[model samples]
Target: MGELARALTRHGIRVRVVAAHSPGLPVYGKIGDIEIVRPRYWWPERLEMLRREVGGLPVVWRKYPLARVQILSFFLMHAFVTARYAQSCDVVHAQWTLSAGAACLGRWVHRCPVLVTVYGSDILQVPRHPIGAWLTWLVLSCCDRITAVSHALQKRVVQLGVSPERVLVVPIGVDVTKFLPADDVHRENLILFVGSLIERKGVRYLLEAMPQILSVFPEYRLVIAGDGPEIISLKQRAVELGISRQVDFVGFQSQDNVRVLMQRARVVVLPSLEEGMGAVLVEAMACGTPVVASRVDGIQDVVTEEVGVLVSPANPMELAEGIRTVLFDPIRWREYSYNARLRAVKYYNWDIIVPRFIQIYQSLVG
Candidate 1:
């Protein structure tokens, strides 16, 4: 969002980010040239973003009645807040499909166009819930326009009975300048995985493959970054597999630290069973790091023979082989590194991606 806001600002499109964060008085701020208005939602605001980020105390909201009430209350609150702020805006660009549901209500209040962007799991995983499918379909049906972060997600939107013409594929871009390779530092034999520690992320398969990886490249170490419900289970799995000493569960690091890790690793792996676009792959690529990922969803969109290798999801032997193949051949390693950087700069940079968004906005407004 920071990248998108800055890019829109750069294109002379004034952007005011409306964010929902933890409890506090509504705060207004600037990130670069863009203005931001963060209006706290509902009372207490302690449970703000609980559905999105798994950061709250497990409460009764997970139950149907309480959860539905919260959702309805939030829709009313969000719509009211958004309508007033978006009064002068040409279009309201909501981040997630669920947010799009709120934005759709806000649009009815304000009489403005709404463009909803799907960032992977929102479209891919949300529909699996009993009520989520109908809500997703309703939101997609209500939007003036829909932009998915990848072709895979766009296809999913179409599957939800949306016309092929209504959904556009606008891939998420990374800050190439910040994620660039550090030539002065020596890269290590670190197999880095940066994402939420969840089942869908396929971190288990990567952990499963670690013993084989360590068998061939004994010096190699696995670094699992990010946090989630499965952290303890994953740790226990590592210990059971006897690779506890070889794996590092660094919880969740700051973005700068992640960049540093990306620069230091020999190969970055995201063995996701499902993904939106796997933005981490592009970030690693931007840092001139080769990737070994599953041939699923948007990971397949970005990774190719030139930049990285893709294997079947949940297959440890195949993943281990792909990683080993990338690691063993220095000639291919050099090629992969060079191509990774090139691919990131060519396609995944914000400067290139933001214009595509502006185009969508223009078409919608017209």
Candidate 2:
């Protein structure tokens, strides 16, 4: 969204972004001529209400009923706010599937063109739920244009009945300046993983592979960054495997912190079963850190042999072996690290990506 917003702004278009209230507000605020409207929520009050309702329900009933209500409320509230804010815009550009649903409703009421971008899970995972699937179809059919982050996602959108001509592939761009390599290589005994602690992210696989990794390289330490619902379980698993001492769970780090962490580490790892474009992989590459990722759709597109090592998803043995290969061979590591930076500058940087988005927006609104 930041990339597209900046791209459009550069082309003499005033861009307004509506996002959830959280981190990264200041970054958006600094973008000249762009208006950012973040929806605010009274977290304490909301949490109290949620707690009251949740306490009354039986465990079985609490799962689906409460989940459905919360989701519905979020969609309705976002739709209401987005419609009001998007009234003056010529086109509504939505970033995700839920946002697309909100945009679809907003466009319907205001009679504006709606463009929805699908970035993996929004098309693949969301559509599996009955309500989400219905909303997915509605947004796909109503949108003026459907942009996907990858060709794989474009195909998924088309399979969901969106027109082939309306769908465009526009991968997210990396900020070359913020993510470039450190001035000097300070070799450290660190292996870093930066992403959500979800099962699909294959965090469990990383933890499972720890024993093997430690057996061969006892001095090597694994740094797990980012937090999610599965953190507790992951921690428990690490303890059960007797590798908790070797794992460092560094909660969530800022972009600057992540870049620094990537620069200091020997290699970065992402073992996701599925991904949109794996933006962090490029970020690691941009920082001159060799990556070991799954050979899944989005990861495959990003982590070529030239830049990083690709292994089968959810296979602990393969993941461990791949990490070993990169860590043991300094010659191979140096070559991959060099190529990774080159790939980031050539293909994945914001300069290249932003222009492509500008072309899309110009073609749509001109």
Model number with the top lDDT? 1
Error of 2 at 306 (Å): 0.6
Per-residue error (Å), model 1, residue 221:
0.9
RMSD after CA superposition, every candidate: 2.5, 4.5
Off by over 4 Å in 2: 2-13, 21-33, 40-45, 48-67
Tens-place lDDT digits, model 2, residues 1-366: 675677667657788888754333332353478888765432433431222321112221234455445555556767877898788877788888777788777666766777788787778777777876777888789888888887778887888888899998877787888787875547588999998776678999998987898898899999999876678899999999999999999998888899899989888999999887898898899999999999887676788899878999999999999999998878998899999999988988777877776677667778
lDDT of 1 by residue, 112-213 (tens): 799999887668877877687888989889998888888889888888788999888888898888899868357997999998887788999999999998
Q: Output the TM-score of candidate 2.
A: 0.88
Q: For model 2, which pairs clash?
A: none
Candidate 1 — what's its lDDT? Answer: 0.84
In each prediction, how many residue pairs overlap at the backbone (N, C-alpha, C within less than 3 A)? 0, 0
Error of 2 at 20 (Å): 2.5
